[model samples]
Target: MTTHYLLNKLRQENPLVHSITNQVVSNDVANSLLAIGASPMMAMAPEEMEEVTKFAKAVVLNIGTLTTEILEAMLIVGKAANKKGVPVILDPVGVGATQFRQEAVSMLLKEVTIQLITGNAGEMAYLAGIDWSSKGVDAGEGKASGREIAERVARRYQTVAAVSGKEDFVSDGRMTIGILNGDPMLTRVTGTGCMLSGICGAYLAVGGKPVLESTVEACTAYGVAAEIAVENKEVNGPGSFRASLIDALYNLSEQTIRDKENIKRYHVNKSEEGTNE
Candidate 1:
């Protein structure tokens, strides 16, 4: 696929992405979207949620700071996006942490028609209704491979699934892709996963592409930026690396993203054992 072509289209379109995300990562998400040449609008008011998503290119619903109020708003906005034919990206943060968290994720799945669900392996497994070792939002361990969990969840939800980790895996049931381009430093930073969800929102906004390809493009672009950010000699720690990550996103060229991304595409069947596609 011509991934960088989509990157260029995103830059040119600069689509408006409506995100109902956590307050903790609001600035990070907003600034990262700005750097990537996409507009970010963070609106969580129940009264305005549906209105804002009416014309938005994409809607992002995150459960990082899940509350009953936000949950209701997410449902309203998700329906609005569906009505408008706008794509919705759902981030099931901490789905394996507590009963409340699990219930909240369950409610979302039952209500909204999510186009993409992005999280770690534990979160993906939880969404797939399988057992996975987890505490808080971070993953502990899982019997299934990230690809297997992602594929299962995608089929179960009938939505694209992206399991982010050292090796990010994205699947839309029929096809799965492994992206090996990010930096380990991404783990040390808080809300980076949230930021990645934001990136996915940005790309999904500029539609006219398959959900799997759009998601893979977003992950690859974000991963390339992270890789370049850590390579900088001055970025010696998480804080600096985080800041450099934004700058790197702004300066990244479409040519570089196409040439440097390490992507492995796979075709998955009912058994979930994938073959190189």
Candidate 2:
């Protein structure tokens, strides 16, 4: 797949992405969408979710700062998007950390037919019923394999699963890709994952590519931008890196994506062994 083609298509369409995200990262999420050339709207009221989702190209639901009221709105908007056949992305941030979080995420999975779910390895592992470690919103030390977890979760939910870490993984159970092009500094800043989820929503909003392809494109573009941001001498620290990252995103071109994307596709035989042969 051509990374530049999807990026170009997204810029041309500028589809509206509706995000019902956490308060801590709402501003960053909205800005990230705009920087990526997507129109972003943050609307979560139960009264307006269906109306907003009826016209929005994609919808992103995050459970970072979960609340009962917000949960209700998410259900409303998720179902609304499903009814319209609008692609829905779920970021189950900090799942398995609390009982309510676990229950909420499980409920959403059962209630909505999510097109994709993006999360750290820990979150994905939990969704797959694997034993992996997690702390706060970060994926902690764990024994479970990110790849296996992603594929398992994708199979279980029948949705595209994306597990992001030093190396990002995307799978739909049958096929998976390992995307290697991100800066470690991304973890230094809060809400970068949330922002990435927003980017996924933007790329998916264009609605021309499969869920896995759109996801890979979004993560690749973000990783490329982060690489550029950290390499910039003017970027002194995380704060500067954040601004520079956004600038890099704004300046990201189709040529750059075509030239710099680092992607690896993984497929398994009947024995379930791959990426090694």
Error of 2 at 3 (Å): 4.0
Error of 1 at 14 (Å): 1.3
The runs of at least 3 residues in candidate 1 whose Cα sits more than 4 Å from the true structure, single-residue gaps closed, are 270-277
Q: What lDDT tens digits, residue by residue, belong to model 1 across residues 1-277? A: 4546777788899999998887888999999999998999998889998678766899998999989899889889988888888988999888888888888878888887899999988888888877888878887797889888888888888889999988999998888999998999999998999999999999998887898988998999999999999999999899999999999999999888988889998888656533222
Backbone clashes in model 2, listed as residue pairs: none
Q: What is the TM-score (0 to 1) of candidate 1?
A: 0.95
Global lDDT for candidate 2? 0.89
Q: Which digits, one per residue and each the tens of the lDDT, describe model 2 over residues 208-271?
A: 7889888999989999999988999999999999999989999999789778889989884455
| Position 71, candidate 1: lDDT | 88
Off by over 4 Å in 2: 271-277
| lDDT by candidate, in order shown | 0.88, 0.89
Which pairs clash inside model 1?
Answer: none
